[model samples]
Target: MDAKAWDERYAGTELVWSAEPNRFVAAETGDLPPGRALDLAAGEGRNSIWLAKQGWQVTAVDFSAAALAKGKLLADAQGASVEWITADLVTWTPKAEAYDLVLIAYLHLPEDEMQSVLAKAAHSLAPGGTFLLIGHDLANLTEGVGGPQDPSILHTPDKVSAALPGVNVTRAERVRRPVTVEGEPREAIDTLVRAVRA
Candidate 1:
């Protein structure tokens, strides 16, 4: 969905996604000492706020204005300091080699666009900095559950790894998340990639 559609989705009073940070995001960055962090396509700034609580200086960027507005309120209420920006991820260029951690979660797009965004994000990382991406896997449509049906926009671990040409990929594979659907347990497959810039 585009920014306008996302705005309408976030227009309601209730939260669209959970207030907590993504499980993978927390797991990967937990052990690392807090530093400058950037979250691209940071809807509602859930992960960004969490990073702030963990003592990281965070910058959250998303295209949806309504989502960021809600995020600002949530950050304020939580007393977390974060810098929020509104911009298109495909064209938004972050400062080069300035971040200790750069995270891109569930930002599904076409293959070329995804590669472009990932490359830019990887480039923003300082040496030894972490770059993590988690998203609905391409195989999820056939093997897993609950994600975008469009095959073109789905992510693959290999694709994400390929995007960060020179980076050291520590992890690149499909991970499963357990969820309940109509009282029945199900697993959702997602692509996970964690790399370190050198």
Candidate 2:
């Protein structure tokens, strides 16, 4: 969705996403010490805020102003600090080797666009810094509870690893995780890939 569409969606709702950090995001990044972090497509800053609470200096980037505003509000309520940027990830150029941790969670896109953005993310990582991605696996479209119906946008561990240059995958797997949304037996087949700059 474009910025305007996202803005409308955010404006129409009190919380577009949950206030808690993504389960994969927390599990994968928990071992790392707090430092400079970048959250791409940081809708409502859930993960960013959590990182901030752990003493990481966080920059949360998203295209929708409304979403950023909501993120700011949540941060304020939590007494956490995060730098918020409003820009399209497709066109945004992050500084090379500028972050200790770079995270992309559930930012599904077409193959070409996904490759471009993930490459930028990998390049933005500092040496020894970790780059983590968690997204709806292609299997989710046919087997999971809820996600974008478009197969072109679903991501896999191989595809995400393929997007990085000079990075070694420490962990890559297709995991079947339970999504405990109330009132339903919901689950998502998602890929978790963690790589580090070489």
Candidate 3:
């Protein structure tokens, strides 16, 4: 969606996503110590805010100004401080080896941009730092309930891991979780990748 389109979506409501951090996010990083983190495509800053609450310094980046504004407001209301940045990831030159933890959740992009973004995401991780990527699997469009309908854009764990050659992929798997949205039983098929910068 375009900036104006996203602005309109966020402009009308409180926020479509839940205020709490993603379940996968909590499960993966629960054992880690608080540290500097970067959340990419952080639409409403739910994960970023959760990191801040855990005593981690976080930077949340997104292209939509309206989303960032709501994220900031939510952060303030939660008594958490996180650096909010508005930038198009396609052109955003993220600093290499800058973050102890890098979070990328539901950041779907066109096929052409996927390789470059995945490479950039791996490059942005600090040595020994954790990189978490969660997205709707292409299989979800046909086999699962809800996600990006376009199959070309949906990603797989191997696809992401292959895009970043230097990073050591510690975990790559397709997982299923039940999501109940408005009393409807929906299953979300997500491709999750956890890597450590080598």
User: Best TM-score goes to which candidate?
Assistant: 1
Ordered from best to worst lDDT, the candidate numbers read: 1, 2, 3
- Which candidate would rank higher by TM-score, 1 or 3? 1
TM-score of 1: 0.98
Candidate 1 lDDT over residue span 1-198, tens digit each: 899999999999899999999999999999999999999999999999999999999999999999999999999999999999999998889999999999998998888888899989989999989999999999999999998999999998887898896689999999998879999999999999999998
lDDT of 2 by residue, 1-198 (tens): 888998999996579888999988999999999889999999889999999999999999999999999999999999999999999999998999999999999898779988999999999999999999998899988888688888889988888898898789999889887877677767789989999998
What does the lDDT read for residue 26 in candidate 3? Answer: 90
Candidate 2 TM-score, true structure as reference: 0.96
Model 3: per-residue lDDT, tens digit, 1-198?
A: 877788788886678789999999999998888888999999989999999999999999998989989999999999999999999888897899998899999988887787788888888888888999999998888778788888888989888888875778999999887988789998989999998887
C-alpha lDDT of residue 160 in model 2: 89
Task: State every prediction's TM-score relative to the real structure.
Answer: 0.98, 0.96, 0.96
Please give the range of 10 consecutive residues that has the lowest summed lDDT in model 2.
Answer: 178-187
> Which pairs of residues collide in model 2?
none
In the order shown, the candidates' Cα RMSDs to the true structure are: 0.8, 1.2, 1.1
lDDT, model 3: 0.89
Candidate 3, residue 167: lDDT: 79
